[model samples]
Target: MFKNILLLLCMTALSTPAFAQDHAAQNADIAPDMPAKFTVNTDKFDFIRRDVMIPMRDGAKLHTVILIPKSAHNAPILLTRTPYNATLMTSKAESGTMRSVLQGYDNMPDVIADGGYIRVVQDVRGKYGSEGQYVMNRPLRGALNHTKVDHSTDTWDTIEWLVHNLPQSNEKVGIIGVSYDGYTSLTALINPHPALKVSVPMNPMVDGWMGDDWFHNGAFREEMLSYIYNQDATAKKTAIWWGNQYDNYDLFLNSISAGALGKERGMEQIGFFRQLLAHPAYDSWWQQQAMDHVLADLPLKVPTLLVHSLWDQEDNYGAIALYYALKQKQADQPNLWLAMGPWNHGGEIKEASTLGPIKLPSDTGLYFRKKILEPFLAHYLKDDAVALPQRVSAYRSGSDDWETREALPARDCTTDCTTLHLTAKYQLAMNGSAETSGSVSYLSDPAHPVPYVQRPVITRGAANSAWDNWLSTDQRNAASRPDVATFTSPVLTQPVSLDGQPLVHLTATTSGTDGDFVVKLIDVYPDEVPEQRELGGYQLMVSSDILRGRYRKSFEHPEAIPANQAQLYQFRLPIMNHTFLPGHRIMVQVQSSWFPLYDRNPQTYVSSIFTAPPEAYKPATITIDTAKSWLTVHTADVATP
Candidate 1:
């Protein structure tokens, strides 16, 4: 269950601060009550007088760690409901054990205690101390034996109990959390108690679709996230799933082929890990779990501040898609303001001062507490003079600069869509508006396929790992191999903005009835300078994805190709917020294998995505449809609002 994700590991120490007094500074200010110094009641603060048991309507009980502020005055309450074991939330269940030194506890207790608020942490149902059978996705249904409860239902019930029992200010409650807890924050809003007025879902789950933690267009994430239900506490009933859940992943690695499991590579996996082999197509199994379809089921009456990471190695992309989708829905009632940074899953980016070679003034976390949580809580709950405003800032890895936009990126366009003909001789060019054509070829061997860059080195589960950079490396580097094909673009004299996802159209013939088409979007940088850091000091990998040649026509059910017969394939990759500068270059690398990243295509039409034994994979060439194949990207002009 230990995944090495990039969740806000960013570390921005109090170094030289940015002096550019921008608008973020104007409206996004700290509370006047911020103390120059503070005190932590180490004993009372650290001690959980008792392990409180919370009950849900479904006859289920939840285990919680309640930390009361030293103040006897009934003030507002701040709660964080997490799945990462209640013990890790705040203070220390026991020191020098799982955590080093209460992880900046002084900062946490200082913030909440200073406000005279009670902080509580609960192990989500089916995880850690909480009781309930542990299902990774935690199917909307409770467990096989326990009371059934869903996220929305659980929070609604949880708040109902807190308002009456806690001595806090009458029913006035504030909820804040990140990742799974972030999702809980938003989930609370949909079916919230009257006391739930202000909430923040930081880098929350939008739903599993194009941006879900895993399975981007049927592509499985290589790393597996283990459902290590170390402990489960429910209604005084408890169950712990024994040992390390992830270590046995190998036993099920091939389970996809046996029609015995579901992909659990990322958040999307959380919803349907059990059906990985069953639902190769976006059938009812996946569609039902898709949160986008269920937002209508939400009662989003509370004011909300949504936060996501721009370079989050995990759920940000999906959350971004959700933000735009909700904005377009015209249901702005929640005033659902959004904030995006360059952080990761668990604030990893915030703790990391550098991204590869780029040394940030501070990990994106510097402004996290000050610019986001603090101002948000002040404006909504405390009615402070300074309120937080809607923010849309993207950190460009190349320039080490942050660009602010008035609004989110709704849509954009490309200046041109050019087709390059890949002759046998390796020539490249943009065909005229009329029609241009050429071709390239490479072999895809199931036996020796391309591996997911991060799989072997790191555990292949969890969508937000620091290892995500593995997905974006230059494809050209892959082209040097005999099995992969590479295509280059003429150096541009002007900047090219690829602000949205791109579509690749290819015409090809497979040696067998099935195969796959892999396309990578690469940013070829400029000539390197010695001291200034290399052109690719960032190795800024943009995006890459694979498409089952058979599913090129429909995602529902795929149709295999006629052996030795040529065919056309089309696939779309995730969107981007980028501007390829004048001096830079663009390169597209195409491959057949993305490794454990996606199940290997058997090169034979089968019912599942991974329908093969290691030996069943045959070497086949992906003949490029030169005259017919083309890559198109959506570009935008820099005309600021």
Candidate 2:
């Protein structure tokens, strides 16, 4: 038996190598023939697409895609630098026509295709196909940023390359974008290149802490967490926001606190999240990055067209703020222009005939592109193009028409403004002051905060999310809440037009050491609308804002509120250009919390609200002095452009 076993083992081992050799020979014989490279034929296409790696001043290569019309020669270049993937922005469809591929965000297909302009879009450093490290709105080369290169230097390098490399293009270049890309367009203005003749920064992000994406006053905009996670977690934004719950209200409520929620979602791994955790106040880190402050000292050399949206949800504070900042310093410069439109953030690219239930007289988006943007660009970039005539073009909401002016607000708002007083009877009066004796009080529970919009509060950017037109939502939902204090003005017999920022002054007291106050300026429609039945009694929000009580003393240094004592809190809402028609009524609603949109204030003071314990959040009684609260709005006579 032993001899038989030894013979079997030897036979198996000898046959194994013979079988392996036979298999290897078979694999070599059947090897597939495939080409390593192939060429794409473009004779049938009307546009030429060139993808190149643009070298920056710091040696980092940014991915850029340029689209040139087949019949083009010496055509001016229109550029957009964005952190959002340039490949996605420039490639919308698989078609031979250039217009078909450029029909997405931040693009006007008709203007680009018909006007014969070469279109270019690039990925900023460290985003998408670009090579470098990523930083959220990287500060300029100074104390904050230890690096030698910034967005300004990168833009200068890019423009230098484009003019020299592109033989089918004119030397003139124009930069334009919305939001983050808009922010990049603004950066190009700092020590701009000779080729950069025009810039259009539409709804740019000027400041994160003051009123932009991250925070408003001192309250953290909690809804923007998903954006930070998705944008910063990976280079390709591969990290998905795993929000298991359908309603964001429940998702946020169940988490107890923003800090706790962030931890549970693994936000500790992101750099921006760590920075957000480190700085919860308006410190030097945030102040130095504000574009309004940074551009105040720089010269306004290029012809810049500042486009502001009346209902811009993400960046309502940016373009307007930067415009005013630059205007204060360079008021005499004719190159600086302003155009205020009736749309949401980046809404100029879409069909802007109406927003929600409110309808406009014309397609304002089309009018803007043909009449305002095209002319503005042509005059600067094209040699034979006619010059633009208007310096300021603003759209009036209630009138549903465009108005041109030499200056904004049409008049000096400080001297021509009207003050509306809030009386103890819950009436908005033009003459009588607020009641000196009594006050309005309500119970504010953190467990049951006021919703920013009607619930089933879906996550932002989700399918059918209310983020697009939440600014135009009916105020009745908030006014009906028990915690919200409502004050209404008598129906206007004649039209009253507001053309500037609305200043809010509230004298209030809270039972807790820390709290939040939300003030909303609404335009309440008449009880009946025969033409549009669904619009009847629609309480539209014209302008609104919020301020954390801790920052009442100072934005830099927060202090606890003296409980049960009347303290005056004053802040400015976003700018507005609306007319309260004869039958419309003006209403102001004040509340303690605007939830999930902004994180819930602990109501009790702690060193840092971001790290506040769950027990710190408690119910409190809030009181508003009726006689002391008043709203001041700038009025203008309605006129057509």
Candidate 2: which pairs clash? 434-627, 435-627
Q: Poorest 10 consecutive residues of model 1 by lDDT?
A: 227-236
Q: What lDDT tens digits, residue by residue, belong to model 2 across residues 382-458? A: 87857694888988888777889887762234776778777777777764644434688888999998888899888
RMSD of 2: 2.8
For residues 579-608, write the lDDT of model 1, one tens digit per residue.
Answer: 666666666667787665556677877666
Q: TM-score winner among the candidates?
A: 2
User: How many Å off is the CA of 219 in candidate 1?
Assistant: 2.4
- Residue 520 CA displacement from its true place in model 1, Å: 2.0
Please, what is the whole-model Cα lDDT of each candidate in the order they appear?
A: 0.58, 0.88
TM-score of each: 0.76, 0.94
Highest lDDT scorer: 2
Instruction: Note each model's CA RMSD in angstroms.
Output: 16.4, 2.8
Model 2 stretches with alpha carbons more than 4 Å out: 1-40, 410-412, 431-437, 639-641
Model 1: how far is 295 from its true place, Å? 0.8
